[model samples]
Target: MEDRYSAVVDLQGDSKQAAEFSAKNLNKNIMLEVENKDENELVDVVREGYLTTNSGFLKEDVNGGTCCVTALIRKGNLIVSNAGDCRAVMSRNGVAEALTTEEHMDGKANA
Candidate 1:
């Protein structure tokens, strides 16, 4: 069986400081540990969104700020882990199956 794993962390905010800080911290926290499992593991994907600013105010705006982090661990065709608006799907025998659902603040939408 093919063993693979992927992770992604996305940070979005109107303030540059917030986005940069989140991205940096997220990246720093990503690491792999010994698990007695044999497979190729990839580092986490940390993505930072653009910054938003208000022309009227000279300060950073925190409204509508959003950040997302995802982790995928796979072993011998089996995947395991936590995820958040992220999506995972697999196709077998011409059928597609979703693994995880997105997390959103609105409670109605996925992250």
Candidate 2:
């Protein structure tokens, strides 16, 4: 998470704040879920963070949206966790490879 994302720099009461909520909480929730030892825990945390943070923003009547990405490299495995439009990509032998494709705000795979 970026330092500026620590909180909403400007209280626009808009989606930017909600996006900050997503980024900040994604950092927090991922740590909370790490102990589950589940392979998909990162992704699950991202999903939960998205909902929980947005819920708070909505409860406060803040408008806007959030998107996030999470990834873990463990035991020689590259795990990609994507939520919203966040994506990951890599290169192999000068070839670019997409780890996750961009999707709509609803969190569905791109068609």
Candidate 3:
């Protein structure tokens, strides 16, 4: 079997208190439940992983919201899921590839 890897970044409200709370409650249930290797499964894993890692408190501001970004790398295949403005990108052979599209208030943005 090939090696599998995962990374997560959780960004909460613009205050230290909010960020702290968000990180503390970040769930990791998906990592403990995923087992398939298909594309849909990979996407589901990425989505659930992000949710699990970014659940917590938030601030009361227009731009101050909680967001999570997740990346899953299995051998040469890569999958990513993101919320808010968080982003994930991959580079191969000098070519840049977008792993996760950013979710911004303005719309989807490139990372």
Give the best candidate by lDDT.
2
TM-score, candidate 3, is 0.49
Please, what are the lDDT tens digits per residue for candidate 3 over residues 1-111? Answer: 899898744443255554554455433444565555565576566555545444323123322455555555666766566666566667899988877754443333122
Give the per-residue lDDT of model 1 (tens digit) for 9-89.
443435455445545544343322313334443321211111111111224344323334444354543333222334666
For all candidates in order, the CA lDDT equals 0.37, 0.61, 0.52
Q: Write the per-residue lDDT of candidate 2 for residues 34-110, one digit (tens) a residue.
A: 66657645455555655655566678665666555666665565556565656777889999888877655573322
| TM-score per candidate, chains pooled | 0.33, 0.60, 0.49
Winner by lDDT between candidate 3 and candidate 2: 2
Regions more than 4 Å wrong, model 3: 1-14, 21-27, 35-40, 52-64, 103-111
| Pairs in clash, predicted candidate 2 | 15-63, 15-64
Point out the higher-scoring one by TM-score: 2 or 3: 2
Better of 1 and 3 by TM-score: 3
TM-score ranking from best to worst?
2, 3, 1
